[model samples]
Target chain A: MEVMIMKRAIGVLDSGVGGLTVVKELMRQLPKEEIIYIGDTERCPYGPRPHDEIEAYTWELIEFLLSKNVKMIVIACNTATAVVLKEARKRLNIPVIGVIDPGARAAVKGTRNKHIGVIGTKMTIESNSYETALRHVAGEIDVYSLACPPFVPLVEAGELDGERVRAIVAETIRPLQSSEMDTLILGCTHYPLLAPVIQDVVGPDVHLISSGDETALEVAAILDFKELENDLDTVPAHQFYATGDVVIFDRLATEWLGQPVRAEKVEVSGVDA
Target chain B: MEVMIMKRAIGVLDSGVGGLTVVKELMRQLPKEEIIYIGDTERCPYGPRPHDEIEAYTWELIEFLLSKNVKMIVIACNTATAVVLKEARKRLNIPVIGVIDPGARAAVKGTRNKHIGVIGTKMTIESNSYETALRHVAGEIDVYSLACPPFVPLVEAGELDGERVRAIVAETIRPLQSSEMDTLILGCTHYPLLAPVIQDVVGPDVHLISSGDETALEVAAILDFKELENDLDTVPAHQFYATGDVVIFDRLATEWLGQPVRAEKVEVSGVDA
Candidate 1:
């Protein structure tokens, strides 16, 4: 008799429900691959935390996924990716991808007027990762970045479409309207859910680049190149983990993924320095 | 002291100047990496040919690029990709990507109502590659395919805009007007150059997916994953080869790429069984 082993799953980590946007994309792009996602909702919004603390929490999430025998790691949160991507890539033997470079590359290619705008959390904007990556590809392009701290909170509260959310989005984007930017990068994973309002404000001329969609394309290509793709004929089940209330996490995942999702609450300990 | 050698260039092949669309994308996404493109203009319009003949001619182009030591291959022509992508991937050691999957994946994701349409050459539409690829991702989505043979000639003749091009586009796309497809795939590389007129005919509600842009994203990801990316500080030079008139090829390349191009005419013999 011959024995068969289950294929390893792709691991994804984020501070909260924001990374679900990326998960939705992965499911669409690579339907056969199994996924294991962790949301650190117990300490949600790693955006406002100190760099060292955010790094420690991200590592803890990585360790948990490693225990689950994940074949790859995707840092879907902008704050975590900007802070710990280099260190994670160095320490992990498997492939590690961050959302920043893919998004940056798309924005650079999508822009025609050499002017690009980026909107993200305070940590991501302050880090200036997008500017560095974009300038690295094209030396003379202009980059404009703004910090929208309230946008993430609005998304987590499930205020995606309404007058209040639209007003907030318009007010936050009012400053960039006259900047004459031909491309805009939604730096945070949570931002895609709010894309319609953002698109309405920016008008149709300015292209909106979503980090999740770009990242998913990168993931599919990497898997094919590395030969790590799941080729089994069996349909794989996806697993979701949260460090806080399972009910809330399940509700958000179900709504965003357009399917019934059950998330389990797991306590993750901090990693040592 | 250790001396570093230059990295191999990315190889791109097309039946004619149509593949410049893909080259334009690669330059934007991977600016540091060198590229070597081959356009078999002496045997242009492979759409109406038999599958076996198209495969043989495509291999001859591949052999020429292999002699140049390319790190990867991109089948930029829709008819060739539909017939030879699998065998090419099997025979080549490096990664091989086709335009069909990327365009199909984008169309699947871009559609909100689960209805999509594909436009390509007669051979490509008859191959049913897009329908198979799209259904592999989503089981119940609707796919409509149409063959527009006259579109390519208009592009090669530099009739990209004006009332004449718009009228031709409207007439060619009239068959799919009642299909209720929310997303349309420009399955052929030449179609993107005519996007303005196509968009005008399709109206504002329908989204257009460009295979060149999507394939470039996949190429960048694979290069990063395989660690085959050129990290040198030297400026990369691109090389162009044609099997037909160098003057005509040079004119089209320079006009489309917005840069001065010098094409070398080379004779490529068909492969024998």
Candidate 2:
């Protein structure tokens, strides 16, 4: 009998260590498939960056992943996903995904009052990516968007839980308390690391939608629909890269992922755009 | 300014009123898209029928929906989906969806122990569709499938909640209790109507993966990816058809859907297979 080799890995890129939330879920949800992830921790918060700058950085990451011969690409950063998702899909041969849409879809399904809340980086909220995405597939939705800038920094520092985190979450999330939103989309990837704190602040009645978790489900759906899933029997070797502090990323990856992962440093400028 | 015309409706077919569960979700999640649903309530339980007969009946339903000029199609009946899904995709021009994969994907996502339980019609369980779909995406998954042949009749009889239904569900779902499955997929489309009882039987720790709700989310994701979603300003004009007892189907549709809907009768033989 002839042998059938395994297919190519899926490429995932993000602004920083946040995308590991997506990676963890992918590992759990689609264990057979291999994944390659790159986080630009050096230029970490893509949220405050200009549109052109964000797209240019995103395209470079795409090219590097393309060179690795990935079968599909997932823009795991909500900020970048909002800025460059449409263009990347048009430019690339592979199917490209955004974190925004999956969370939006899940929020639509989970909500009973059609009232949704979104908390993300300033750029993600200002771009109205969650609102646009939520309204694109769903109709007549009441969207309440808030920008939570401190959440990412907390995760990057490997500070997931404590009184400090809870106090910050309670104060920051207080604005949306009166919205009466039943489903809150954690629009930023790093937000999931603080999900328990966020969920606590939002109360038990409100469901928190994690972009990382929901995107993993969407990735599985796309693979099945496109017939691009890997049917390999070999153990998957997941690769992780960070542009800034590999030490910090490595520690957080191991801690958050519940597995040991060594992150390598990569210079974003060295990759061909 | 140029106006954009609305897209065509999505065609959905099932073995009987069980598929209305899917329709209810589609309405809730995707309020913009028009839906055309047909149920072969005459030959209601496709679960007991041979594969060849299921395919023939499904093809006739597909042809009727095609005549209405739908943009996409969904096989809402788990039994028919398992039998006809692959062949139908190969023959159809538009994207065709099945109820099994979505539930399988969700179960894989929701399960914490990598152990899952599936409860479906006899044919769906016997076909090993859930196991196939689950293992196809994720590796090393333990799936326990039970053929709850009595559950469908309970839903069809419109006896959703009562002590009698609770006793039947508790008895039928007892096999899965020993499986140590963290996620239990209601593999039959009709199962969602009976979800409260099933959940009570299985307990709260086990996450119930409703095929109808999951498929609705998948439908939204596919629509966004394919750009087949409707962007019309007009309210959707939904249509319902049944090959058997229109009155019974109509009553179930309105009651389960929580909306007043009139189902029309059609002769399945008149439609070309």
Candidate 1: segments with Cα more than 4 A from true spot: A1-8, A29-33, A50-52, A90-94, A161-164, A224-236, A270-273, B1-7, B231-235, B270-273
DockQ of 1: 0.41
What digit string (tens of lDDT, one per residue) describes model 1 on residues A11-32?
Answer: 9999988999999999877777
State the TM-score, rounded to 2 decimals, of chain A in model 1.
0.95
**Mind giving the per-residue lDDT tens digits that candidate 1 earns over B30-57?**
7888899999998888887877889899
What does candidate 2's lDDT look like per residue over B18-103, in tens digits? 88999999999999899999999888778777777888999999999999988889999988888888888888888899999999
Model 2 chain B: worst 10 consecutive residues (lDDT sum): B1-10
Candidate 2: where are CA atoms >4 Å away?
Answer: A1-6, A270-273, B1-6, B270-273
lDDT of each: 0.87, 0.88
